[model samples]
Target: MRILNTIESALSGFLFLLGIVISLYSVFMRYVLGASQSWATEVYTMLLVWAIFIGFSTALKEDKHIAIEFLYDKSGPTMKKVSQVIVFIIGIGFSLFIIWTGFNMVLTAYSQQIKTIDLGFPIWINYLIMPIAGILLFIRFCEKAYKYFVKHEEVTHGGDVEWKQ
Candidate 1:
């Protein structure tokens, strides 16, 4: 899980940087050179989408996702613990839903022969990251659950926690 998180973070970072570079280059070409790179927009969009989806796992691993902590902060210890269990259940269910929907989307795209406008690659190539990232996210959530419930570790990856167990 550690290795998977590291790889996912690195890949997402690389993709984000590459997307930025591609967008900047396209801008330069269009405005300065009076000619745009036709494939740049599609490629940049694809890279950015992949980066965001892939980074979801890293964010989950690090506990960096945004949350509405107002009610949680007001909850008691037992309620807090129950909330954690509920959160884990929801996360797992959401991940599975994403995997199923994403798989269906990929199959539909493949069957329909959908292609990108500029690059002409199959649209599924861009969508392929969804299920992969969803699986990684599910793994991260499981790791969190194991650490909290089995290992009895506090699940705080450098986040502010106003409540105590």
Candidate 2:
């Protein structure tokens, strides 16, 4: 679990840094060099996609995914657990759907040899980020569910909560 968390964090961090660097370079090229590469936009778009996907899993592992806590905080432990289960099921289902659809989309893109307007780079490569991120999210969801049901552990007040389900 620790290793998974570390890997997810590292991946997310690397994607984020990569995105920042690419964006900065793009900006520098446009402003300082007075010329923009046709592929700059595509590069940024790809980086953003990767960052979003990796960030999704990292957020799940960190229990930083968005939620409405007003009602949850007022509920009892049993209710909390029930809520967690419901959320997990729904979240996992949605992530799986994305993975399925994203896979098909990537396949179609690859088969068609889709390319961006300005860059002419293979569009499938950019679309691949969706499935990759979806898979990571699915893994994180399973880990959360396992910890919730099998580990039966609670996070401390100041510590990160092992998301129940």
Candidate 3:
């Protein structure tokens, strides 16, 4: 899990930097060189999609995903733990569904031999991010679920408790 997290984080960071470089280079090519690079936009778009989906999973694992924690923070220990469990279970199920559907889409595109306009690559190569994201999401949620089931809970002195990842 640790190694996977590190790889995801590094890939996310690299894609982000590479995306920026691509965009800047595209601008320079268009404005300064007076010649447009047709492939730049398509590549940048693909990079953006990959970066967001991949980085999203890492963020979810790190508990950086956004949520309405106000009510959770004000909840009692039992309620807080229960809410977390409910949320994680729902997330796991949703992720599984996404994985199933995404894999189907990838397979369909592959069978159809769909190709990208600029890159002339199989479009499935682009849509492949969907299942990859779903798998990462599933793993992260399962890890959280495991923690919820196996880890000892923190007993609080206050009436309300705040739950962090």
Candidate 4:
């Protein structure tokens, strides 16, 4: 799992960097050189999509995702455990939904021969990250559930955050 998380982080980081580079290059070409690249917008948008979806798993592993912290902080121990169970169930359900819908979307795109507007690449390639990330999310959520419930470890969720007046 550590290796998998490392790989996920690397892949998402690369995609994010590539997206930023592409967007900067596009801006430089348009403003500095007075010429526009037609494929740049679509390419960067696709890269951003891939980066965000893939990076979600990495964020989950690191516990960087946002939560309603105020209510959670006020909850008792029993309520906290109950909340964790509820969140775990919801996470599993959402992961399965993402897998199912994302897979179907890819199949549909492939069958319909959907292509990007500028680059003409198949749309399914852009969507391939969805199910992969979904699977990763599922695994991480299960790991967290086990650590929290079975091992009696506390699941951190923004407890240290200080609210501003």
All candidates: TM-score:
0.92, 0.87, 0.89, 0.92
- C-alpha lDDT of residue 109 in model 2: 97
Stretches off by above 4 angstroms in model 3 are: 153-165
Higher-TM-score candidate of 1 and 3: 1
Better of 2 and 3 by TM-score: 3
What is candidate 2's lDDT per residue for 9-63, written digit by digit as tens?
7876787788788888989998999988667777776877787787888777777
**Candidate 1, after superposition: displacement of residue 108 in Å?**
0.9
> Which candidate model has the greater TM-score, 1 or 2?
1
lDDT of 3 at 99: 93
Cα lDDT tens digits, model 3, 1-165, are 989988999998888789889999999999999999989998888888899999978877767777767887699878977887788879999899889988999999999999989889789988899999999999988876766566643322232323545
lDDT of 2 at 153: 60
Judging by TM-score, tell me the better candidate of 1 and 4.
1
Candidate numbers sorted by lDDT from highest down: 1, 4, 3, 2
Better of 2 and 4 by lDDT: 4
Candidate 4 — what's its lDDT?
0.86
Clash pairs detected, candidate 2: none
Q: State the local distance difference test value for candidate 2.
A: 0.79
Count of clashing residue pairs in every prediction: 0, 0, 0, 0
Please list the Cα RMSD from the true structure of every candidate, rounded to 1 decimal place.
2.3, 2.9, 4.0, 4.6
